[model samples]
Target chain A: MLTAAPERSSHTIALVGLPNSGKSTVFNALTGFRQRTANYPGVTIAPFVGWVHRDGHSVAFVDLPGIYSLSPKSEDEHLAVRFLRGELPDAPTPDRLLVIVDGTQLERGLVLLSWVAPLHLPTALVITMIDELKARGGVLDVEELERRLGIPVFTVVGRRGIGIEEIRRSALAWEPWGIPFLPLPPDASVEERYQWARELSAAVLHFPRPDTRSERIDQVALHPVWGLILFAMVMMLFFQAIFTLAQPGMEALEAGIGWLQQMVENTLPEGILRNFLSHGILGGVGAVVVFLPQIALLYFLLTLLEDSGYFARAAFVVDRFLGSFGLQGRAFFPLLGGFACAIPAILSTRVIPSWQERLTTMLIIPLMTCSARLPVYTLLITATIPPVSVGGVISAQALVMMGLYLLGAGTGLIIAWLLRHTLLRGAKAPFILELPPYRLPAWRTVLGRTWSSTWAFIHTAGTIILALSIVLWALTEIPPVSVPPGTPPLEAQRLQLENSLAGQIGHLLQPLFAPLGFDWKITVAILGSFAAREVFISFLGQLYAIDVEAAEGTLRHVLAQTLPIPVALSLLTFYVYALQCISTMAVLRRESGSWRWVALALGYTFALAYCLSFLVYQAARWLLG
Target chain B: MGQTEIEVPLNRAPLRRQLVVRRYEGESSVIERLCELGLTIGTQLLIRRRAPLGGGIEVEFRGVRVGLRLREAAVLYVTACGDSNAYRSS
Candidate 1:
């Protein structure tokens, strides 16, 4: 909320760490709520930056992807190197780098410092996970290590916000030399550098008995049988948590959006413009926003698992399946995460050694049911499938929904199998994965990380959703034309939207859908819903907003008034089959660096959906008619 | 039911008893993966725990839970971690 341009006196600080090094937790503590999220050039991995104002200076702290070496392989790794080299788009090179190392893994994490030290940048080692180490009879001679390294090394345990302020102050106070982590003379081979680093570590470092929890956890968690069970149970719990806990909040959101639409209707002058804004924009776009709770909750649970070390074992559990699918075993984690959201999932696919596996995983990840699809599925199922009991143990409606989800998953797997033999077919890729030791769930770190990610979704991605909603609203509301209609559209279309251009287009698209049971109204809604799957509800909300059948239960009846039951089932089935998600497309473009793959995927899915729906509807009409 | 006592055909189901690895009994790509993880002879393995949806099995060895599919788990032999009923997964 600065009214004027702030002074360009802010200095950038990069926070670097090894995987699972608690660096992100400290970054969250320092930045709090001030941050920006965007994609790195030529890659999907989004780097984050946040501001911390201390004393009189604005300090911008950046969280870079964790890596073991300065050498680049993955796009994210390349971005890290480039940024360290003072080259990045939309970002000035950092003034200093903070290398955070896990104290328990000091031997391994210190390898990064040798590379960083020679660069000659003013660097500090934020020794993290110290609390875990201390509880396990481990102790670090921090002063001695600092004396040997000749850098201001701060001992930290950021999950609890401990030692965070100290590190920040030290970083703010330190002055830097011109050089950073430069290599030794050209005559010296890598062996010489390794020798020097090992000698230095031996002279200065102290390691008491390191915590063995990770090893113990790894033994049980990564075991051949039990580990797999625990991993699945954990993932299933996360999936179930989203559906179970986020429902009431979703209802509230739906109600709120509904109330707002009503408010806009009552306040605006009665015309196509007002009707279009309320029904088209608010209805079409607002529906997608309702899924924010589910998305946020999903991220919360995922971040929780990731902060703990259980996630690695889960990947280990599925490594064989990934290998069978012609994907690298490491591809399992990112693809599993793709079931939640594709952005982080695709970005994390960097662990895959080959581009083909990464591309294959990305192509099929959208086939996994994302939260965007959940809203539409819920709306449709509630409308069609009656709530009933099955042997008094299961909810019939719930079972059907679960079955549909399984169907999507099964089909996605089958599709991947087919693709492995066909279009992108290749020899199965090799696997190289790091199975890090497990740690206790740091709930504070999980919460902070979740909040940061959720904030990004709301501010950056959510705004794009909103803009699309507004444009969709205009499409459905303008034109003010006569409806050459056989069926009345949903509530959003009942307003003066009947005369708008969007309504006319919807009217025109009606016949293309009539065979599958939709009239002009449903056709219009589905057409705009192509941008996102879950928007089907809000699209209907906007479409139905203009109609009298704006209430929830009334929508199905309204559709039935136009098309037969067979057609409704066909539409539902079509939604189930077609890979209809905008986020999925964005991720595909990111992973492949080309839109061809996405276009091909979209074409194949839509073609398959239409063919299946057509056959199912026609067969049903012949029999059930 | 120990690795030394139970010697079933390589394709048949693994015995209920836990076993110590006498040796990796195959030479396919899958075996190469196991080799990469340093799963050699004298390694203790129990294949009782597994994921519900054909994900894999959990074998306890050197105090770590390693999840491997029956495809690979079949390659290991062992005595039961504990005396129990047959481990049948859904």
Candidate 2:
């Protein structure tokens, strides 16, 4: 046996568990909230790493991806096993292994531990969700479990902070950790290991009742007819709530920004600084931030659905439909998330167990017409389409907006099908999803997740959105035009924009976009929008310098007068199919660990956008003429 | 019909009825995954219900609920428990 003890000053500990085993809750409890996610070298997944300072000896806790066993079938499973065996490049082999198991399902947890025992790492067991187990009238003999496994056993109700500090103190005292006894022989077959785990768990645990509540819920949730109806109703209520609930908050934020802009205009001198502060900073970031209400609410409801265990049943219900399109039910989550923002949506795709399905979902997510597209769609539709009711029911503009959303989603499904058949064709991975027991979601965890995802959006807005806004401001305002003193301010701003560098580039690119009926000004907006779809509205607002609200009469009259019906229709079509978010592309690059998908996504989306827009423009022109 | 002749692939196993895992009839990798999840010869599983439009089967075993796609579930052959058809450890 090796005699060297782990360094006394610091230690690296790894946490592993099966999915939905409360591993993350324990990790959060141990590490607090100051966790940093680092992508493993050459891998598509990034595990959370955090540091806990105890008694002046800092312990770095690595929350490895959740897996059922150490088998290397899936990429996440492969990464976990590789990290455990010190085979993952650049990642330190953990000094000790912290295995987490669900208190309710101790047998399966023990089986997982059995898989890791052959490595002979100094290991300890953390049994989480003890509160839930006890609520079901289950009892666990923690001391007996420790004795049988020959390792330190800790039971934690991670949500309530019970038995957490003890784990932390034990982690700090790392040297005396026992080498966990192998639950089964190293060469034992899977069946033997499970039998051993069953016997061992039967000895140390007793549960008098089953999770009948989950079964009762699943009967309706997974029913052939009622399940679909419940799913549809849930989705409808969810989106309806998002729009209605977020409206007032959105208006408040808009008013808040307007108030701030007024203050900046009043305080700052009338020059580039004032214009930059009002239009460039507030206008750019504020436009994106205005949607935070919708995003936060969307994530909140999604967290509730997920924590209530309804999300898995929803996935099961939709599996056949998505499978027909070469996707899977788990793809539903990311696709739904796409309606909010593609960045977090792509991150959420980590739950998908298969690589091809996950990548397919990520690639097509931008086609879902994210919240960023709403402003653009609203601007164009209100400017062009009349508010007269279609068939005396839905307004024409609202109908058009709904049609655009359908077009985006339908195209995404078609593209997924095409890619599945051509580029990403592979045998479907077995879909084995564990339906966790239904419980009232912990409010703290739900709120924490919602806040973190919302924060991610704000981070994107601060960096990418703010940067793009500034760049567009520079491009449109540089080489200040020399207008006569009597020139009107609005006219002067337009002249400055037309004479700026962006104007020259727009003119240069006009011929390329002319087939889709885009003039140089619209071309400039499109070019700026390549960084972010929402940037198009800000760019157009700047180019027009129409101080009034964009959806109001003045800007609408200006747009309707400047562009014919055909051109307006074409631009709307282009926005529907275009992949307009560079931030999403960057995330794709990072997640896929290759620039190949990024290039393909950019290429195909642009081509599809151009062709579809050209066709719409020509068709509308012919019909109108 | 004799219980022995009524053995069927797990995908066709009757819903909410206890069935015994009889034989491994799937690819090795798939069988390994099933074993790891505690589905082994002679182990009993209760078929909870099929998903909407026959997408997958939810099986309950060892106090756990697991959903398996129809294709994946077809790999295991199971017989009704408490019968001669049920496999006995040799």
Candidate 3:
């Protein structure tokens, strides 16, 4: 749904620029509309589409993937080239073009412009980072550039919102804008086009000094040993912030959900409506929503790192190690994002240029212990493991949690190695990444992206999760059984559940899962968790007739009493390896563009889950005996 | 004089030295990408810094900095031209 095509507008402008040319900054500054992710039919990583409205005029602008030239090489660049030429099906051909150029790199920008000149589209030049240029003793004569290229030129500082409104006003008036005049022949060679760009740039742009500050920073930031140390420090800080900084926010959200549940209970009468409202709706969604703090922080920190230009250096630092494993440095971000949520992490693998490497990266992302699995892991560890300190340093429960994370990450690496050698093996693609100059992160962009990603999470909770919760409620509540009027509430609920559709399905699957030490009730909750990992806790709460909001303490107590240590450990092992998230599978299908790969991924993960869980259960049983 | 202009792969080129692109011998896709990034023949480039642990080398040309893996860099043949300081604006 996020990548649906944009609504057609009367007039559309396509924004084209090289990567790190501040193209997204300009798009974010000008467009007030909610951005829609645009996925062209054969494109793996889609462009962004948004609308700019002013003075009763609205123009849809598609932000094409950053490309250095129109000559198609990569899949996304081919899509960009085709989209500009009106060749892509199911996507509207743009009416005009906004050619964005980095103020500091006019010559390189002109090379790209040279390719676009032949398209004969109504093109206007947008010069970003003008401030960075001037600070470095560079001169860009916008009027001279306009005269030289026969294109309207405007300079804007996207970070500070400088001249944004003027660009918005003129973006809709492309009819009178100057189209680039190509002096060279239509069949000019690459060398000739570059020569033309060089002459044109020399005439209009001048840089008297190099970016000494960036070079100085890179001395340490890109240093072999120090650079790696710094990279590790940054990663440590990132994960540390996610856990420490998000705690208070998570607690507040939990308390808010608890209060809302209380309000609903006081207002609604005792019956199906009350039970559904408090336990079904609130319980199911609240469990997922509590992780909102971690999700928001993850995107916030990632955006900051990307905008500040440190991510590229980190990738550079790790390229050798990751390359040894048949994955490139760009895969690092998606794998790290997997820790927050595999849905977004899988989406992020688009940065990798190679199809084989990208597929390998995507296949391993679900094994990285996403935040959705955190609640399930915590519950099991708290229930099965003792709280005694390990060597008087860390609690055994904490140690178990850390061990599970390491296991997930370790297993993901091993599988990546295997996939690279077997199913997805291919020659490595060229790793040529531009390292943009570091600058202060734009707060507006950071906060906006955080809100959008967080909003996406809420949307998921409201739709897919809500629908699944309703289905779970219906499956457990239907075919209600009669009980004595004086019977206990918990017993009555259990009786009704045993007769419901879910109970029947669970009974059917229980024998299959018996090797893993799971009972019928656990089978039911495990099945419900396929919608999302966090739903397991709510399902267990529902089956036990406990309010999920306040069930954390009681649920742990109840689980410890009802479940043996072996079963709990086995279940934890299952979650560590199972591909349980439907949303993740959906994203994997869309990204890989093949349901066959999805089936393969599902098969492999399920096999791993079953085999490891069976082994753990049997070993535990033998040890206890 | 022609013999004096020895060509070396960019990955083996000395750090902070200005070099001219002689030719690229690699996969067509890789060569095309390099040209599109303005590494066409005769364009002057400087090896700004080499990443630690053989990660890659940072190459600067046309005032744009790009990180290229050693494998990709090894495909680009370059001839040492002038001092890096003299080609500051390349």
Candidate rank order under lDDT = 3, 2, 1
lDDT (Cα atoms) of all candidates against the true structure: 0.64, 0.82, 0.82
RMSD of 3: 4.5
lDDT at position A161, candidate 2: 73
Residue-level error in angstroms, candidate 2, position A533: 1.9
Q: Tell me the lDDT of model 1 at A239.
A: 69
TM-scores for every candidate against the unseen true structure: 0.79, 0.92, 0.93
lDDT of 2 by residue, A195-262 (tens): 88878887888854667888888888888888889999988887788778988999999899989999
Q: What is the lDDT of residue A215 in candidate 3?
A: 82
Q: What is the interface RMSD of each candidate, in Å?
A: 9.4, 2.6, 1.7
Root mean square deviation (Cα) for candidate 2? 3.5
Candidate number with the higher TM-score (1 or 2): 2
Name the regions of candidate 2 deviating beyond 4 angstroms.
Answer: A1-8, A39-43, A173-175, A247-261, A270-293, A454-462, A546-553, B83-90
Candidate 3 backbone collisions, by pair: A224-B52, B62-B90
Considering the two chains of model 3, state its CAPRI-style docking category: medium
**Candidate 3 Cα errors over 4 Å, as ranges:** A1-9, A38-46, A72-79, A173-175, A456-462, A544-553, B1-4, B83-85
Which 10-residue span in candidate 3 chain A carries the lowest summed lDDT? A544-553
> Best candidate, DockQ-wise?
3
Clashing pairs in 2: none
Of the two candidates 1 and 3, the one with more favorable lDDT, higher being better, is: 3
